[model samples]
Target: MNPAVTPHQQIRATHDAETVRVYQAFSDEIADAALARGTFVSPPFKMERMTWIKPSFLWMMYRAGWGLKDEGQRRILAIDITREGFDWALTNSCPSHPGEAMGKEDWAKVKDASPVRIQWDPERDLFLQPMGYRTIQIGLGKDAVRRYVSQWIRRISEVTPLAHEIHNLVRQGRLLEAKEKLPVERPLS
Candidate 1:
């Protein structure tokens, strides 16, 4: 069952009329190389493989251990892309588990047919505790993976500094200021 999600833990999509922002974590080998080359060049990334993106800063930190640990999670990227493209994926996405969005038949099709799956994990706080809300983690596979790398991404910038900044804030018990500096996100339509 999904955890209870509340507003305090949600990181809404920032898209207004045109674009939305998404975050991805990569290993230094991938992130460092991409930053130096000005694009994704290392490992070729097997566009056919599944890639995940998160919109919540704390959730990502929980997933990445705040960049202190986790192989290939040392670098984080904030990417700006067309809202249309993101909406397309959300519309096509299947819930990772059987829930309101899917019944038996829908889940069957999702297993092999859908390119994306959405999982809502419990929201995390600065210290990585489960918060009252939840965050979105979307998995991109199949054709969706290809489209994401070749078409969807517009701008990619490193946000490792911000990740560390927040981490430090939390460590120093400056939760309020850290929360204020976080990215403003809205729920997807």
Candidate 2:
């Protein structure tokens, strides 16, 4: 197991040498279509809109409410995509917020041009409480989205069942069991 990181922002995910896992929550129609085709399609999954992908499972649970959030976010999907594609997005990304180093106009121009947006939000624990550190959330758009759909995606699996199971365990105060049920997430090397 990798040592716990102390950095405020990091990319901790379930990953192998070739691929990394990301999570997305979708409605039944979108999830069904994507699952059936092995990739997202147009009718339900709009390509024009920016899509955010999260690597932290607990953060995802918080956002999706363990698959009970709403119809629009009822299905949780674990998507494994090529490390190359993931790296590409990071290399070409602009920060979602303007940094002190850059002026607003400059940041806006860069953000408008970049195909990916990177934001670091507070991480979550087993009970979905915010942690001290932050998790990376990648927002894909335009070319990045095209590449993600066509060249990046390796596999997609529904994990709403696992989400519910972990949630139940947490609710029952079985913190250890719930923590064990979480996917092994390590900082991406």
Candidate 3:
């Protein structure tokens, strides 16, 4: 069952039509940048504009790449980025507490599984949906939250332009400008 999500939460979760388009446009721009930077690679799936991506989704992605030691002091697992298998990985054993730091292998495994999606690429007049789950995991402890915040900053840095645009919109009090730009008539499916 779907729990009641707060308005703020809803805003964070759901992306309106225009927002989806914006993200797609940004993704294409990123792809182009990646190509220019020699980071471009062919991917499967058709990308589409996203209506919204939930915070939980972002949390899940972050958790997958996070390096946490288990009780046995083994290797930390990572979330597999492939379209197959479980979405997370572990290094050693799960940690008893959040104080210990994760090692390189643990971070790589999870970072490799980071989920990135492209909603609608207006440049191509096409939609793309790249696979790989991007999410952050919220833990029960205060320390865990702190770590999550730190991790969140790093992840957001991956999409600097989009992040900056969002921040600017909020700072300029223009986030609601979309309401006026979109047509009032219901869109046809």
Candidate 4:
């Protein structure tokens, strides 16, 4: 936790020198195809549509219901992508909605031209409750998706089991144990 970071919005993620890990919940078909190819493919994983990726593990678990949300979101994937690509998305992104900084007309024009969209959602705790701070959700459009699939991804892993394990711990009131299982996420510089 950096002292300079405000409690409202921050980008915290599991990352190393070259790559940052993002979470996405997908169907079995998409997961299988992506895992097999080590990247997303067209047939199962649509390229023309927007894909949202989350850096917060607990927030992902909350959204996907610990990998038991639905068949469409049954498989939880931990994707390690190049920091360069992640930074590119951030640099070219527009806010998902209009903010005080911009009017709707100007925002609409910017969003239409940008390939990435950003949204800040409430972060989650070990028990999957919304925290005071917010985490980022990056939505990739066609152009950004092209870069992500062709040049960004380094590793793809299935973490559905880990999700269930942590969920079980939390359900049993083992806060420390569950917290220990979480990925070490630090504020991205």
Each candidate: what lDDT? Answer: 0.76, 0.93, 0.25, 0.94
What's the lDDT of the predicted structure labeled candidate 2?
A: 0.93
Which candidate gets the maximum lDDT versus the true structure? 4
Candidate 4, residues 61-89: lDDT per residue as tens digits? 99999999899999999999999999999
Runs off by more than 4 Å, candidate 2 = 1-5
TM-score, candidate number 3: 0.24
True lDDT of residue 47, candidate 1? 68
RMSD of 2: 1.6
Backbone clash total for model 4 is 0
Q: TM-scores, in order shown?
A: 0.84, 0.96, 0.24, 0.96
User: C-alpha displacement of 25 in model 3, angstroms?
Assistant: 21
lDDT of 3: 0.25
TM-score of predicted model 1? 0.84
lDDT of 3 by residue, 1-189 (tens): 122321111212222332211111124444444334332223311223211222332222222221122222111111111111111111212322222377767755644443332122111100112223222211113332222222321112133333334334545767575224322222111
Give the least accurate 10-residue stretch of model 2, judged by summed lDDT.
Answer: 1-10
